[model samples]
Target chain A: MKVLEAETYQAGEVHRFEAAGQEFVYLAPAGGIFGISAAAAAVLETMGAAGRRMDELRAEMRAAGFSAGDVEEALEELIEARVLERPRTLPPPRQKMPERFPLQSLVMNLTNQCNLSCKYCYEYGEDKVATPDGKPKFMDWETAKASVDFFLQDSAGRERLHITFFGGETLMNFPLLKKVVDYAEAAAGAQGRAVDFSLTTNATLLTPAIIGFLADKRIGVTVSIDGPPDMNKLRVFANGRPSYDVIAPKIRELLARHRTRPVGARVTLTAEVTDCIRIFRHLTEDLGFQEVGFAPVTSSQKNLVTIGSGKMDSILEQFCALADEYLAAALENRQHAFSNVTDTIAELHEGVNKSHPCGAALGLVGVGPSGDIAPCHRFVDSDTHKLGNVFTGIDRSKQADFLERGHIDAKYDCHTCWARPLCAGGCHHEAYVRYGDTGHPNLHYCDWIRTWTDKCLRVYGAIAAQNPGFLEHFERRKAS
Target chain B: MKHLRAVNRKAVRVAGEIDAAAADVHALQEGAPPQPKPVPHYPVGCTIVFSPGWEVDSSGGTAGLCQPAERDLYDCYATCFWPAQVPDHLNNYPDWTKKCASATKDWREIDLVFP
Candidate 1:
């Protein structure tokens, strides 16, 4: 480990770049972006190299059209903004885990059974723990009601709540899902609150009736399809037959019918299915998905389809290629289908400093078909990570322990990394699958995440510089 | 200040010696002017009000508002209540204030959102 020496006025850790003829600085400490004036830029330059005394920096700022008082004010502002740094007078404080955090959303795992047995399916893969021997294969209406009530009660004073349906194939339990929607709507309505419904499906079981119901209820749908038939080699049926042909027409009907919320496509990128650009094209252009998101498959090291280091590098390159397309579309005030870039940019724009990997176990939790609660969808069937059962309340002690262990402060490897605010040590389930510990950092993707973050930073800088109005429009769309 | 139209009547004192009864020092109250017609070309669902300053508080005064305006940003964004200026973080930008621990100390990190 490298030691930092004492400094009077050191420059803060920042990524500086010029885009669209405007200079920008991404402040590492605060995750803030600032467009410096010429005077502030000069002060940054004068102190950029090494720490300098107040008198010394003031002398230079005086020459740059700043009065003595003005220079002092400017320096203080910079220090406050974390654009300039001073040695901490006190030791850094540890972040405390919040108690009594309310839940905002729940992921309901509809079933442990699936029609398609994707080669890298995490639910049934090597890493998966066998479903509890007596657990039901599909979630029943009673459990679904209990989960909805649990979610609403846990959310307490919340004006709105969200529930996402998940499963080996969410559509496998469509009848129950329909009942839960109506029940949840009436329940929330009685309480003078609103509830939003969304689901992730393989689309193989979607019928005209299902599509019409989804459209009428305005339920958001996310289809899990890799890409065109050629790219979806691993996403096959139980009998080892391809599934693209079956799902494509169904997805088309769903997209055509579902008009309230844009239907998104979630692509699982495996070692064999590494063609991100082609997959993105087929999903967004050919199949007409409003947004397409790609996630590298999560699996144990022994899983053959698990992406190794070399393949991960290639995936990063493909992600960057798609990001460039996103950038081009953004510059012209157009929407792009690359949800990864859009999601990251949104986080960057919001200056998200996550203590945990995500909202899992914090604002969100997952319920299995048997009413057992887990941290998230990925942990639904896993017997190891159950937080509690929906009938009983979430176990506070267990949840606290999981959060404390997963906190950024507990992740030693992430202490010095500037991207920790955005990444927060990567996905918890991925860490658990790869390292046998939920608290372990996903070291394999550190470089990839850092590179991808930098690319997004530049994309944000370019947009803030050239077409800032687009950012406003984007924010409005997101809010709406 | 030059472009802004003064909304309320107030006394303006010149910081210099002046004649007690000087022409510019009169305390006369002027008659109110007729209200102008609303702009016809303005789009519907517009929330932008042509007020004299940034915003007025519930009491119809600026004193009740948070100082420096940024202090109230997180409050407004968090609840998405009365989001006339900042982006609402409740339903829309739920993660907007995730990085902002204390708005007073981290005001610079607050994002600028427009209607």
Candidate 2:
């Protein structure tokens, strides 16, 4: 906490806005937006444009007609909050990762072949084309086996581990999934470790047998469905017919059969659909999913149907509406049907502050259909971002490069952004897709994120105050 | 504006690590899930393997890390990767286990102290 000096001081990025007839300065670095007298807002506005000496600032404040006491108190408050701080020179960068890295998760891209061609699909969601590296569409069982072995061995010291089967559709390669499950179980048993299995599927290809198998093996499944038929216009069969009708019954069947573990519904929100509450209702209330989450379409490609600035406010408003519903349900000791609300609530319930948006290059690596390792599932098809191959092991330099790019300091704007800790430079892959540079943070959604987070914070405060017992449900949810 | 309170910040951390301990004791005594041992915070699906080979107490007052030797067959005394209590994310998160990938070490910490 640098104290503002009377001799000299620098103002960080302080966003000044007038909301609800009150003057406010949102100090981004401090994660505080304070309502101050209009005079104080004027002071911050002037000072924030450039660094200034204290006496010069006072003179400006006085000329602007602010009283000595108000100006003094305003400066005191700003300095106390670390909004105004001493300027400093940059320090040399240090190593961003450990020399001996710990491997905790292996995301296996079972195959690149998919039956459904969703418009928002990042992996050339355009066509059944070869991978960006021009590799074959399917992963060989041998490569998959080796990758599993590597994670179990490399992450041996870890008491528990997870293997996520990702792909064009994991069920597209059911045989490999089964074989890997058996092999992983045997391997974990030998290592005295526990391995949990999860998969993200489109639900177009799931049959009774596959659902039974997943339930039998206790593999958690997350079905990708936007909403009712009209909401999922972008998701279609390879032949270009809407897939909601075809996948809906399959999803219901999956929910009915996959009894061993909870089945979550994952909805991808594109520019076409910002009706969050409606989609959430259909997924959880209408469809009976245990939980449901939403991930906005991330590709910045011109051809993709990505969410734009126009829809973010409506999306945020709808999310807050659902959050209110989540609060109502939680206070009554009932589980909310909305996964997004529940997830944010859980984080707030637990006070989770993340520095990175996710565990991409750290312990979690996404193995492509071939033997290649990418930063995460999103980067699996991106050749440039490929960190290494499973058979060859991680290319420390490339992996380290991607990891370093994600370091908060490496991002120019993120260091000063109040949301840096949780946004973690936004999604690394999103940055790569948008700017063609992995180090950049996607500023496109920064406003939406900050606004959404603010809503979550408010929701947390309400639930914590009204229903303390609702938090106990965390234990039950964790157990369930 | 009121600042964030410390207690509210760390509420229900590791499901109150103590409550979990009590539940574990209750389960051993009642041979049922009397109270659930709080959920450990190693993300969902990850398990913690505690250190083994503990010296047990022959007497059975309470079977714990070193409580009752007779009841101490499986209870982990030393630390396990999966701590029973979740770290208080607000106050003491970014524990030794690992930092969330998004959290980078701020470079400013390396600068020399100035008067």
Candidate 3:
């Protein structure tokens, strides 16, 4: 079944093919087959064998004293049956993956180096280790420039670009970080594009100067704070002292400086469900942060304990209960928004056809010190998802094929399931590191996404009932 | 007697010069009763005059004299009535009869009548 001829449309393409005993119509690009009646087919033949514009065909039938309405209905039936293909420009022939738009965030690790040595840190993880030298390294200015250039090329026509600085602590390499941001902003301006900046920091190195720079640049910040001092014991420095006292004051100062900008917290769940909820509440209610997100620490080789489905279920239940609390707080405050992972899940449920829900790994390219481009910051060391090197620039031709290989060979079982489109086969790096294959769907994350989706629909309904106009405005903003 | 004369007039006008092969193919394709030989009726210079109140039956399924034998009638009717429906006001004449009288004054005319 080769497509001998095809006409592309915005909705989908249509192709005419001869297979088995008869001629068949197929929706091209996606490749769904449709069945049209013999009478309708004869009418089509009379109009022209090659093809005619729909309106012209309709008029010709009408002038020839045929039922215009019947012909129109038959055309639609043919379309639905996959007998006719709608016309559309095909994706770039050379690329391995189709271009996906409206990317959510791009994660850029300013430097793989970090100050604190957390037990669960990827740098210290058995799978990915720093060089024998104890000193943390930084990304040079030239590589950073190339990274920005690569991003602009890959993300052409994307509505907004969010550059999220990550690392051991992105703030530790402040000079190179500033230079990268400056170059990106300048490049974006030259191309007439809009770019937003964000950072996920431990908040240990945040100072008055750092706060001022972030505030001036309008960078959204998410600080990592596990629980109170006791629960945060796992995230300690090389000297093995608690980091809470050091990070807390800096978080307060940065939040004070950028009151209007979004300042959120991320807490990693290492203990039981009860402890996780306690940590979440303490971070949001006690610390006065508007929003907080929770995630389990990645199961690196150093931490050989497998994350079981039982633990994952308990965490989801706790998170769902916490989401209810967060919603209540937002409503009570009348103007606060929490980093409800539910929103991202809800967008997925709404059938947004993104390659991945966590858009980090696709649109955003992370530059290793050696100038290799990993899919994103998280999978910097993994060979499976390493897109290409930035020095040669992005080979656009290989994108589609590369993505197809990743999708097919992904270890995440979810990739084969119907929900694959919504979850995007789960995190590739997480699957590769934990399970030795990217194709396996992380059931833990899948459960979390399902729970979050249900909670979001519930919250969204309540919000819509209270103010019908809110949804309208939100949808409008999404469209624009 | 009047109907026979009308039939003769039509037959005389269309007789002879008809392609025998085309007629044979037409007959074979129809696969029905054989058609009678056509007889030309009108002279070369005679004019056609449609009877007043002889309006075409536009309603479908009538099986009337003016109705077409094909599944569709609009195309046939449009072709048949083009000259008759040419408005008199456009030609500054009192009626279609008057328009035809003035218009064919300088040209030879042929009249067609169907029963």
TM-score, chain B only, every model?
0.35, 0.23, 0.17
Measured by DockQ, the strongest candidate is 2
lDDT of 2 at A184: 92
Model 2 regions more than 4 Å off: A1-96, A125-134, A349-355, A472-480, B1-4, B7-115
DockQ pick, better of 2 and 3: 2
In order, candidate lDDTs are 0.75, 0.68, 0.55
lDDT per residue as tens, model 1, A1-480: 011222277777766665556556666555666665555667778886667876777777788777765565556556655567775566468757766788889999999889999888878757875465688999988899999999999998888888888997888888889899999999999999989999999899999999999889989999989998988888888899999888899998888888989899999888788888889999989999999999988887788887778888888898988888888899899999899988888877766667888999999999999999999998886677989999998988888888987898899998778788789999999999889888999997898888889888778778876677767755664564
Query: Chain A alone, TM-score for each of the models?
Result: 0.92, 0.80, 0.71
Alpha-carbon runs more than 4 Å astray in model 1? A1-7, A38-50, A54-74, A477-480, B1-115
- lDDT tens readout by residue for model 2, A1-480: 222345676665554444334454444443343445665566677686567888888888889888877777667556555456556676435434467667778899899888987887777744212255578688888898889877776685787788999997888899999999999988898878888899999998889998889999999898888998889998988788999888889988888778898799888888888788889889887888988888888766465476766776788888888877887787788877677777765654544445457888888999887778888887786667778787788888887777777777677776666656467778777787788777788888887887776666565555655676777766565544
By summed lDDT, which 10 consecutive residues of candidate 2 chain A come out lowest?
Answer: A24-33
Q: Candidate 2: lDDT of A58? A: 86
TM-score between candidate 3 and the true structure: 0.60
Order by DockQ, highest first: 2, 1, 3
Best lDDT among the predictions, by candidate number: 1
Tens digits of per-residue lDDT, candidate 3, A137-233, equal 6677877777777778767777577788888688878898888788888888888887889888999998898899999998888888787888787
DockQ of 2: 0.04
Superposed on all Cα atoms, the candidates' RMSDs to the truth, in angstroms, are 15.7, 16.3, 20.1
